[model samples]
Target: MINKMQILSLTALGNLDAYIRYANSWPMLSAEEEKLLAERLYYNGDLDAAKTLILSHLRFVIHISRNYSGYGLPQADLIQEGNIGLMKSIRRFNPEVGVRLVSFAVHWIKSEIHEYVLRNWRIVKVATTKSQRKLFFNLRKTKQRLGWFNENELRIVAQELGVCSEDVREMECRMSAQDISFNPFPDDESSDRKLTTVMTHLRDNTSDFANGVEEDNWEMHATNKLTNALRILDKRSRHIIRARWLNENNKITLQEIANGYGISAERVRQLEKNAMKKLRTAIEA
Candidate 1:
């Protein structure tokens, strides 16, 4: 029988091929051998027995993680999460249940990998609600080809998943959108990659010139409107609004402003409300 240290060393350093070979080489234990090991771990709290159970199932986790590689997560990371699941399953395994450890561990392994994929696949999560999660996994299976969903297809998916049609449309939009790079590099023009080089395109003379003119005009218009609005307000009202709303860390409670000005809090609140209403009417006019 292999020792615990030897088994862990093998799992840590072993390649996928080597681990598969090791799993295949180990003869399936007799029912008595399995029962003794499980009892030792569960009843006697034997670490060695637990290690043996986990080592034997590492290859099973690897096999399960491979099925989820289509989601673009690293295979090694997926396998690591699956191994956590396998350990949990081993910790809870019952020899009296009459089923092999592999059968019980499959659920645990896949559950861990599924969570990892959903979390790391996008910046904003693709699935929030339970119905959306079900649709996210099953929508690929329902679609025959890679095109946008038509109204008929949308209705079918919504009905099958027991969600509204608009929910289906929202989820589909989230799923179809790809993440865009903010400041891409110049040498990334490979045929295999989708992101464009931001520096190369943004440095174009025509685009820069046009954007500069548009930005200057907008700034001038905004400055004129602000100046006009300030002229319409009395000095104290203008000062209150500016300090409260225009400062960098701008928002203060009415009580805070009241304390600062040595006035009643209710009076401060009334002033603030009147100031906001006046600003709105001024902006509209």
Candidate 2:
């Protein structure tokens, strides 16, 4: 277990035999040896003592992580989580509790592995309630073979597990189901199958392309009419309209235009209003 993390980093796990040979090399600690190491680390804050305690316990972490292999997860990942749990247990272990570190560490190890399994088991979570969570970890143990349970088997499992048959059936369905992509790739093998994905055939009717194009054309035509209409205004009013509304990058206040023309701001505003009325009438015509 001590060499497990280093081996993971420095070598390929693609070859199974070499990996097994490495796991076999770490020495197991006797009860007396483990307790002494635990005491040294707990009482004196000895760094080497803590390392020895952790290193010696890595084999057990591997042993526990292996039990979770049925969930179709990577075995190395499970062992890594269990190792984390073991470190936590070492940090919290009380030598005065009169239990060996391995005996006490089992809960912490299994708990970390349980969390990992639940999170990765499905794209959508199969178990959220307390009863369902209990079933997630222990449900497989109740199964004797492959495929769905018959009526009698469902009743038996439900009674033994203290859950209803409906819950069992629901969980089984969730377990059997696979994740689907909402928007399939263009390179998907079958055009017909790709069309079956939810997003492929759906349309947003509110923003229909033909209606959008017609509205855009009408708007452009109205803009051309307005531009021609502005030609009817005198220079001063035309300048006011362009400054006040058209040129977003360089707009001027009525007072600024009034200062340039040597008129009151009120007079400039009246001219601006008259220009708009004439432009509207011209555009309508």
lDDT by residue for model 2 over 32-89, one digit each (tens)? 8888888887888776777777767777877888788999998777877887788788
lDDT for 187 in candidate 1 is: 53
Give candidate 2's TM-score: 0.60
| Residue 249, model 2, lDDT | 98
TM-score of each: 0.55, 0.60
- In candidate 1, position 100 carries an lDDT of 83
Residue 111 miss distance in model 2 (angstroms)? 1.3
Q: How many clashing residue pairs, candidate 2?
A: 0
On a 0 to 100 scale, what is the lDDT of residue 81 in model 1? 78
Each model's lDDT comes to 0.76, 0.80
Candidate 1: where are CA atoms >4 Å away? 1-14, 30-32, 129-131, 144-148, 185-285
TM-score of decoy 1:
0.55
Given candidate 1, what's the lDDT at residue 113?
A: 77
